[model samples]
Target: MPISYTDQQIREKAASLGLIQEGADLPRQLRGKVVAAMAYGDAAERHQAPEPQLAGEIVIHGSSILIDGEHFPWLVAAQPMDIGLNPDGVSTVRLTLMAASVQVIRPEPRPESEH
Candidate 1:
């Protein structure tokens, strides 16, 4: 059986994975940043607890995403689609987005003698 997830649950998972921002239009954002799309599945149990693992190469360019899979015709139909991970080991989807604005503060440089 497929695992059921609410919209909030899905959004929370995406946020934790760094796939989407808190209030951003996830689907629209993903579409804007897609270079390619593909269907994915797991080698392990199909109905496992966690989502399926994606075993492939996915390159994330500036607001562009690329996915490569053997059976991914749905991707072609979707053109620009939002990507998310399933916690049932059913399939895998990759995503790419614009260079986000997450700043990292660095300490100011000090003179060698100050050490």
Candidate 2:
């Protein structure tokens, strides 16, 4: 099975592929706003090889987006999910970016009995 890549690895690969340039961050137009991108594949393709779910939250500021949820302020953020490789070997994903600050807050703990 192909190994999954770390956030850093993915970032580097993206840069190498020219999807992103060195030291370039998410577009400023996407800052503080949420946008979504989606891709679709045929059912037969899924039967041949299943894909893993890729979803996460991120923060974006200026020209940078944090990979994982970290304490890095002033960085732009974009979350890409439902990643898949097309027949042409082109990887696709549904990406969303926040136009402004995006806060990912943990759900509040409820009473044990509530579970």
Candidate 3:
């Protein structure tokens, strides 16, 4: 069964994943961040796999936002509708704005020495 999540739940999950700052309330906060929107089931499986999948980049055009070149309303993108788990068992929220499930992800933060 698909897992359902409230906006608060999704925000908590995204914060935990470091995809967004805790308490972020704007879509612009995620602007330019790399995200993957895939089929819900496929996303679940891919999250457990070793290789990562690249979908589209997020482009915020003033009052609007676009992912993979398709338009996504600010309200829908800001409020994720579902949640899933990544390989490490951490929760990843899913946005239903696209025909595919949306997974907002970022690479693990490297230590300052690596920079």
- Cα deviation in Å at residue 33, candidate 2? 22
lDDT of each: 0.49, 0.48, 0.56
> Which stretches of candidate 1 lie above 4 Å from their native place?
28-115
Instruction: Report the C-alpha displacement of residue 35, candidate 3, in angstroms.
Output: 11
lDDT leader: 3
* Residue 75 alpha-carbon offset, candidate 1, angstroms: 53
Query: How much is 41 displaced in model 2, in angstroms?
Result: 20
lDDT of 2 by residue, 16-75 (tens): 656667766645453222121111123345567456644354444444545356654442
> What order do candidates take by TM-score, descending?
1, 3, 2
The TM-score of candidate 1 is 0.24
Per-candidate Cα RMSD to the true structure, in Å, reads 22.1, 24.8, 22.3
lDDT for model 2 comes to: 0.48
Tell me each candidate's TM-score.
Answer: 0.24, 0.20, 0.24
Residue 25, candidate 2: alpha-carbon lDDT? 67
